[model samples]
Target: MNTKGHCCPKYVILQAVYFKLRFTLSYRDVEEIMKIRGVIVDHATIQRWVYKFMPFIEAEMKNRKARVGKSWRMDETYIKVKGIWCYLYRAVDKSGNTVDFLLTRKRQRMSAQSFLIKAIINNYRPRVINIDKSGSNTAAIKVYNRRSFSKIKIRVLSHL
Candidate 1:
């Protein structure tokens, strides 16, 4: 979305978000950076801008992303959110391009299935899925393929 009101230029907003995300900068750091660039913006405003524009930016990137190959890699890792551990399911194409990711509290079969479905919807169905030796992931792929109209191959790898 373009700047509609008496707001900062779109490039400035984009630059602020880019700095904040690309670097390990806090909102205040981003604000100072923007200030050095001659754009005066509050840290809270920067936070609001990130919260508002991140999804739009991601959607635009997804639309512009290159076509993924047939083979895909799927994996899950634990991430600490606030203080508790959460499961982060992520997928990537054979070329190492990011497909999609999902964060959930539980790492169950249903969660894996949901992550796979979301990845398929957002990106594309993979011809072959390589995953670690997780029974839940295997079961989820099995159930999803069974219910899905397309037949997808699942390869269990000892190490991903």
Candidate 2:
């Protein structure tokens, strides 16, 4: 959250970043918002701030997030993002709290594996994982287990 060389105050930059991320507004919309608040900033500057500070923001949010359950349910689905088709991989604890999510351009074992790694890193490793009958998911879990040498029980649900 360092604003070392920034021309505006930290709060102003944060407000612009929050508005852009917390809503569906475009960069120009955030620029207009700053203008309404008497801050003369450009949309491109807001975009730069988001790109610069997003990682730090994500790390802070992850640290503040509640611990997930030991049991998890993993799934993936095809979704349209920015008019492009992509696969969204997600995991939720048994109590229905989200663990983590990732959007990938393809539905494959590598994508699933990367999402699993990210989820495990952000949250504790689950004791059990229930997944739909997707061979890619199964393969990813197997690879993870083999590499980590940790026994994480996997249950394949026939019906998604």
| Model 2 lDDT per residue over 15-47, tens place | 998899999799999999999999999899999
Task: For model 1, state the Cα shift of residue 123 in Å.
Answer: 1.4
Provide TM-scores for the models. 0.71, 0.79
- Candidate 1 TM-score over all chains jointly: 0.71
Deviation in angstroms for 117 in model 1?
2.3
- Deviating ranges (above 4 Å) for candidate 1: 75-92, 95-107, 131-133, 155-160
What digit string (tens of lDDT, one per residue) describes model 1 on residues 111-154?
99999999899877899999999888889889988898668899
Please give the range of 10 consecutive residues that has the lowest summed lDDT in model 2: 54-63
In model 1, which range of ten residues has the least summed lDDT?
Answer: 1-10
Residue 43, model 2, lDDT: 93
Residue 28 lDDT in candidate 2: 100
* Per-model CA lDDT versus the true structure: 0.88, 0.93
Candidate 2 lDDT score at position 53: 89
